[model samples]
Target chain A: MDRLSEVSASLVGGFEYNCIIFFCTLVMAVPLGLVITFGSMSRFKPLKWVSKTFVWIIRGTPLMLQLFVVLYAPGLIFDIPIKSRMTAVLIAFVINYAAYFSEIYRGGIESIPKGQYEAGQVLGLTKPQVFFKVVLFQVIKRVIPAMGNEIITLVKDTSLARIIGVTEIIMCAERFTKQGLIWPLFSTGLFFLAFCGILTLLFGYIEKKLDYYKG
Target chain B: MSILEVNNIHKSFGKTKVLQGVDFTMERGEVLVILGSSGSGKTTLLRCLNFLETADKGKIFVDGRLIFDADNKQKPSRAEIRERQLNFGLVFQSFNLFPQYSALENVTLAPKLLAKERADFKRNKAAIYDEIEKNAIALLDDVGLKDKMNNYPCELSGGQQQRVSIARAMAQDPKILFFDEPTSALDPELTGEVLKIIRSLAAEHKTMVIVTHEIEFARNVADKIVFMSEGVIVEQGAPEEVIDHPKQERTRAFLNKLSK
Candidate 1:
């Protein structure tokens, strides 16, 4: 195959990096986000302060800057080489997304009325049971749209891994551009648009399913 | 013998005393109506009985066991408080049904969790859930919400939500039920449905302590009426004796104000 044909054929394989980043970050970040939310909401002052400070620092800076730091800072400061480009990307992306997700989780959890917890207690539910069985579902339902938006943003964010040499789709397209082909770079946008469109539909269906929670 | 006992229950929010030296007891199957104006501690008394509000000073007994005593054990742990919560069901003024759950789920949840806590239920988990579901459906039918079993609390009207909560209360087959002005959050028209349900429960001779301003309903259903004023029970007797032939000035004044 010529360069164009090869580029066309290789698009799926090249984009695999973005897919890995997207799904891996999502699978790890979401539960980490919930754990961070619990830390932020902890009754113990120190845990809450530490959680808030960590989130504040991540959210205050750019993901690109965090990526640079995650890639170079350990090697620079402690003489420890981060050998895997993918590992650094995963760590940076997961940390950044988890900070954002924790805030959304916190807001969703707090928006629930105190009456809900009281009703659970009155029914003799242990506190953990009340949280997991009753409150967790509501939080998930309420935060889905917000989470969906973040996940879509993540598809675009996977492009940032290219800066650290992850050779994601955008990087592949850029290589094609160096070879005097502009079509692949533009076509990458089509790939994202389809991904995002499918995600939007999935989220719309979820929000519809959760229509039972008009309260 | 008394099924529920509260002795000198005292609670204060900051400097404002809510329940001052409140005392009451109820026999099994007796309906006790706690009648009081706002700020008179009727709601606080009910909360204290269920360990919702820790009493600053008091002793509470459920099924002849000392569940709480402020002086004896000043700071009960959450686990201890939770253990005490198992003895009674509470229906809130706002009908605080688990909004995320359907009417049937709201009725079945606690009982299901309670069942899971027992060793026997572990062997027959499916049977436990089925039995609880059947009872919950029957209870929802009893509260006239059989058709609305799959509806969420937000989907139901205030009266219907209140009815669902009443069914939710009966899910655990509580030793006694507590109503914290169950109709206070309802419209005047909607209040009738909740009142009717309470009337039916009273007829069934269910042990209940209802803190309400519904004088007529209270009078008609309560086996014992307690009138409170300024965080004190100023008068208590048979509804006819207390409402119609009250001997205390505070009681007469409160009734007169309500009447007007």
Candidate 2:
């Protein structure tokens, strides 16, 4: 029992890295995703094409390979020193998740009828004001469910950071397996279930809060 | 000068012309009711007047302030057009209230937003909000939705929703209001409530241009009536003269068809 407790205590330190990767990626990616969504939806043809192709490449490639490229490309191709492995994992995860979230944002934006925009126009609202005041929260309400699914997937995806030399919980648990202890590895699943359960509850509460918006 | 003047309006949708060389002028506080069949360009003419749809050829002036002049080589900028749109209010058949806003918020949104944009609003923020809230409540009450101030659009009935739409347009303090098939989407039983609200608005002598299929309501409320067929105005006159004794054969035939 003491050994399990000791293992759990050590895993907590490793799990901190996983939590940091998850939150940093999310905080950076969501706004970045909206920015990319605007770029993809821009009226300027070249900008739209470039933004779409960038998202396509990021979404098409394996996150593992992207991590490798982001981590090593600077050193090999440009001779620039990369001092932080966490920076590498964060950049790869942020770019990958941003592309996925951008598509979700696009779908949410497009689902709004044109008449809604026209209604705002007739009210003398500027385009930006119309988007922020009338459409932004509604878009957030619509994309929340899709975003919730992606966020839950992100909890598990944090394990990918371990492969990039970040000693996250799974990696810490793997050390115990090497010492002929498998229970700690199994306990990692419980940790993940707790994390995902909290996220699911949070999203469900948000959905109920926005229930007034039927569309 | 008339309150609104549209000279030689023309519109086309692909191969089919929708509004062909339409000319019109409305006096202040005159309720002009347009009547026509579904494909007869009545809604198109109304939409064009409100700048919701741009006419291929036309010039619009509201109280001698030029709103749109398609014939001019130097076109007005987009900002100019949007500024003119603020002078008019449009109500859709679908009651297109923001699904997210409460009934009162729907009425207050534009006015509140416009107030906030002024440089001096920050100095008198509370007063501005209070004034808007007061007007919103009054308008909601006027439309018989005093209790529905907190209800979202989806929560309201079709008749109640259309009533809310009328209040929303009235909230803008528009010089002229335009309605396109306001009660067309409502159930036959629900339309009476909407028509009643409009009848009261007409009694107030508010300038209005309405496109509707309600012949009796038109006869009761219209200061003048226009009859259109196939993208052209066949005739326009006092409701009694047009509805009871239309001069054109097309007008007579349409009135006959509607009564039958």
Candidate 3:
């Protein structure tokens, strides 16, 4: 029982790191992703091309490799290192997840029928009003499922931050495995499973709430 | 002076010319019904008049004020275009109500948004909102949709959805209302309720431009009829002069086909 308490105490500290990374990445990525979506869908050719190319490169590459690059590249390429490990993890994770989220947003926005825009315009709604008042809620309703999938993945992906020496729950469990104690590592799975389960319930609730939006 | 004057309107998509030098004039309180087979530019003409599509070449005057001048070297600003668009309202073939909002919300959304631009909005917020809500409920009731005002678009039938869209259009009280094949998307049994509301609007002497395939309805409701073929107006006159005694061969062929 004493050993179990010790293991639980250390895991809790590591889990705090995971939660911080998870929330910070989400808080920064959600709005950043919307900005990127608008950039990709812009009518200006150069801006659209840049945003598309950036998303393609980030999505094509692996997240683990991005972590290494973000932590090391400024020092290697520019001779000025990213000082904080947490900042590096956050920078890489936010950009990577934002690229994925932007594509989901693009799909949601594009799926709206042209008739909606014409309807809004004929009602004398300016372009921005049409987007905010007419289109935004429908897009939110459509993208929720896809966004939920990414969010669940983000919970697990937070473990990858350990590669940059920013210790998370899984890495803390790994230290116990190295000492020939395996039960704590197995216990780590409970944390992830419970987190994902709660998220599943959350996403299901959101989808039901938006059920009236059939578009 | 004519309430609306569209002169020499021309539009094309890539190489396909949809509207070529179409011209017409509408008096206040006149109902102008446009008839044409599919791909004959009737819908495109309506779209151009509503500013959904900018004409390649033309001039449009509303209330004797120039609204669209394609020949002008500089394009109109977004605000300018929006200001001009306020003069007309369009009901689409498909009832494009915002699915997320209830019927009452859909009818009131545009007016409330426009109301925000008023100088007295902040000081008179409660009164302004109450007035907008009252107007929306009245408009919905006028279209026989009083009971369905709180229902979402998906909860309503196709006819109910169309009625809500008509109420949405009427909320703005436009100078000229345009319908682009409004009932074409509805079930036949459901068409009567919608047509009845339109006939009542006609009886009220509301100026309207309608593009529809309902020959009998057009004959009964139109003050003037314009038959278009191949991107141009072939004939336009009073209903009896144009529908029963068409001068152009194209108009005659169209009426004969409809009769058969």
Candidate 4:
């Protein structure tokens, strides 16, 4: 009982770090992904090429390598250091996951029937109004399941922040293991399992709310 | 004077010409039914009239305003062309109702969008809602689907969906309505119901341009019948004159196939 309580106290700091990365990624990834989707769909050849190339590079490379580069490269190359370890982890995550999310978003938006856009134009809706009023809900409905899967994976991925020396839950638990207490490291599973379980329930609720869009 | 005119319109899609120097004109409140085989460019002609598909070369005038003139290459601004578009409404064969909105909401969307840009937008909302509700109910009542206003497109039958589409087009109160094979997707029983509604619209003197394969419906309802073949207007006159005593060998052959 004493050991469990000691490990739990130490893990609280790590849990906070995990929560920050989770929230930050959600905030940054969704909009950035939308921007990337626009870029890939752009009519300008250079802009489209640049956006697609960036997404390809991010998706092609390892996330761990991205984490190291993001953490170290700014200071090494430009002398403008990214001083915060948590910020560096966030930058790596946003870039990596934004690429993935952009593909999903592009797939969802492109899957809609072209006839729908023509119908909107026939009603005299301008481009922006048509997107927001007609296309946005359908895109959200189509993309939700894919996005939910990524969000659940993001919970597990928060532990990768420890590689950048941010004392997230696993890193906190690892500290106690060095003091010859191995059980604390295993007990960290409780925190992860609980977090994942809650996330599953929340996503299930969201899916239910969007049940009107059966397709 | 003609209310709408299409003069020498030409359109093509990447090496395949769809319309070749087509010309037609409609006076106010004229129901013109265009008959054609598949790929005869009937729908393409309608699309060009609305500027949905820009004609490769043509002149289109709506209410004496030069909307499209390929010779000068000077056209009305986009906003001006859109304003002219308000004069006509199109009903597609596919029943392209905005699937997300309820039928009533679909009926109200365009007016609300237009009203939003006006100065007295908010003050007009209630009156617009009343007008939309009344017109929607009347249109639905005409089509015998008044009870399905709140229903989504998926909940309705094909005929009901098409009726709702007609109601949505009528919601704008356009001067002319365009129908592109409106009954092609409906079963026979449903087709009868839609035909009855369209016939009634004709009776009410609502100007309509219909592209259809239903020869009997065309013979019964059309003020004028235009037979098209291979991207050309082959024969045109009153239905009895064109369908019964066609001048062209092609029109007679086409009618013989339809009877068989």
Candidate 5:
């Protein structure tokens, strides 16, 4: 029982890495995704093509492969090694999720009727003003459900950071398998399940807060 | 000078010509109603005048200032376009209120945004916002929505939503207001409320260009009426001459069909 308690505490400590990656990726990716969405929807053909193609490339490949490339590519191709494993994990996760979020953002933004834009225009609003003032919140209300799904997936995807040696929760639990204790590895599931439960509740509360407006 | 002059406007979507050689003028405070059936380019004409769509060829002058001239090869800047668009207000067939904002917010949004451009906005923000809110409340009350000022568009009836949109347009205090089939989206029983607001606006001597199919309402409110067919004006004159006694065969046929 003492061994189990000690192993559980170690796993909890390792879980901090997962939480850090999740929050760091989210903070960077959400706004970056919006920027990419604007790029993909740009009226200028070259910028639109570049953004679309980049999104396609990121979404088509496996994120595990992206993790490998981000960790090793600089060293192999340019002879300048990445100094920190955590930085590589953050870079890979942020880029991967940003590509996913951008498509969801595009869907939400395009769902708005053209009349909304025309109404703003006829009221003498500049295009940027129309977007920020009239359309942005509507888009937020629409994209929330899809974003919730992606964010939950992101919490699980943080385990992938272990591939580049970031020592997330699962990896810390795996150390107990070497000591002939299997239950500690299985016990990590409780942490994930509880975390996801809390996230689900959080998303549900956010959705209700925005319920005053129908998207 | 005429309050508005459109000299030979033309617009096309690829090969489908929508507005071809359309010309008209309106005196200040004149209610000019454009009457036509579907696909008759009435809405497109209103869009062009409101700068929602660019005309292929035309010159639009409001109060003797040239707003749009396809003859000028230089494209106007964004600020210039916005400045020109401020001269007109457009109410859509579908009431496109920002669903997230309340009725008073909808009415005050544009005026508040425009107020931010004032030189003293930063120092006088509270006073300016209070004044704008006061005006918005007055406008909503004018449209008989004083009690429903806090309702969202989804919460309001279709007629009430349309009235809120009318109040929104009037908040801009535009020189010329354009309506594109305002009641077409409302139920027949509900249209009376919206039409009554417009009738009251006309009584206030507000200059308006309305594109509608309601013949009796047009006759009641229009100072001048322009009848359009196949992307061109078939006839235009006083409401009596056009609605009651149209001279052109096409106009006579259209009025005949509508009356039936």
Candidate 6:
């Protein structure tokens, strides 16, 4: 009983940290991802190559490696510690997820027909208006399924913060394992499964709402 | 004065030439039908008149304004060019309605976006909605799709989709409408329906430029017919003179081939 109470109390701050990371990633990654998509599609050679290379490198490496390097690299290279472990984890999450989200965005935008663009031009719409009014909604509709997969994956990837000593849900569960109380570690699965189930329902609702755009 | 003029317009794609020094002119309120074989630049010539495809070397004048003049080749200011573009509405071979919008919304999009009149967004919305409902229904009635206003383009058939496209263009109320092979994607029955609607529109004295292979439709509806070959206007006159009594050997051979 004492072990359960201790585990729960210790997790309060980590739960808050987890929520912060979740919200920040959603707010930052969507727009950052769009910008990265533009970079990948840029007519200029250098910008396209640089953006694609960054995405490839981030996607190739494991998130655990990224968390460690991000948390320690600033301190090691510049001799000025980043000071906040939470900030390092947040930065690493934003950068890693933005790359994945950008590829999804690019795929969605490219799937639309070239005729739609020509039709917009014929109607005397400027390039920006065409993107916002015509292309944006279609792209959003096409990408929702792919985006849902990434977001559900993101919920699990948040556990990678344990490597940086951020004390997220899994880390709180690990401490109980050291004390010979396996129940708390198993209890953590309840939190993860429940969260994932809610996310699945949320994404299913979104897919239903976008049903009008079915090809 | 000629309302629109094209002189010596030429266009080439990498290695294949599309329009080689094409020339023609149209009086105000004149309906000219363009007829030609498939790669003879009939569609390319129509696109050039609206500046949809820039000509490599030519002069095009709309209402005596030098919209494009290759010798001095000064593209007009953006506002000037938009003003000239407002004079015509173009309908494509494929129905290019924005699939995201409903049929009514598709019809009202251009006017709402341009916002040339109406005081505020509310007034504009009301006016546009009214305009779309009224003319959209009328256009659909004319083209025979009066019941499908709420449906998206994807929900309609190829023929019904083309009618919706015609209605969408008519909603803009431009002085001249251009149709590029509008019935090529439809079956004979659907083609008959669209052609019948176009004939009624012609009765209303709507000035138009149509590039089509439907010889009988052109003969019945076109005030003048221009026969093109190898990117140039080989012959042009009243439909009877050009289609029935051709002077050019190529025009006669082309007509005979289609007749067979």
Among these predicted structures, which one has the highest lDDT?
A: 3
Q: TM-score for candidate 2, please give it.
A: 0.95
Give one digit per residue, the lDDT tens place, for model 1 in B101-171: 89999899898887876779878999889999999999999999999999888889999999999999988
Alpha-carbon runs more than 4 Å astray in model 1: B72-82
Q: How accurate locally is residue A105 in candidate 3, as Cα lDDT from 0 to 100?
A: 99
Q: Stretches of candidate 4 above 4 Å error?
A: A213-215, B71-78
Look at candidate 6 and give me any clashing residue pairs. Answer: none
| Clash pairs for candidate 3 | none
Give the winner by lDDT: 1 or 2.
Answer: 2
* Model 4 Cα lDDT, one tens digit per residue, A1-215: 88778778889878999999998998999999999999999999999999999999999998888999999999999999998998899999998889999999999999888767777777777778778888888898888889988988888899999988999999999989788988878877888889889988887887788775333
For each prediction in turn, the share of the native Cα contacts (below 8 Å between chains A and B) that it retains comes to 0.83, 0.73, 0.85, 0.31, 0.88, 0.29
TM-score of chain A of 3: 0.98
- Looking at model 5, the pairs that clash are none
DockQ of 1: 0.63
Q: Give lDDT for model 4.
A: 0.86
lDDT tens per residue, model 1, A39-146: 999999999999999999999999999999999999999999799999999999999999999999999999988888888988888889989998888888889988
Root mean square deviation (Cα) for candidate 2:
1.8
Write down the worst ten-residue block by lDDT for model 3 chain B: B73-82
DockQ of each: 0.63, 0.65, 0.84, 0.54, 0.85, 0.50
* lDDT (Cα, tens digit) per residue for candidate 3, span A139-203: 99999999999999999999999999988998899999888999998898899999999999999
lDDT of 1 at B62: 83
lDDT of 5 by residue, B1-260 (tens): 99999999999999999998999999998999999888999999998898888899989999999999988989899879888988999899998999999999999999999999999999999999999999999999999999999998989999999999999999999999999999999999999999999999999999999999999999999999999998999999999999888889989888888888
TM-score of chain B of each: 0.96, 0.97, 0.98, 0.95, 0.98, 0.91
The lDDT of each candidate is 0.90, 0.91, 0.94, 0.86, 0.93, 0.84
Clash tally, candidates in order: 0, 0, 0, 1, 0, 0
lDDT of 6: 0.84
Clashes of 4: 1
Ranking by DockQ: 5, 3, 2, 1, 4, 6
What's every prediction's RMSD, in angstroms? Answer: 2.1, 1.8, 0.9, 1.8, 0.9, 2.6
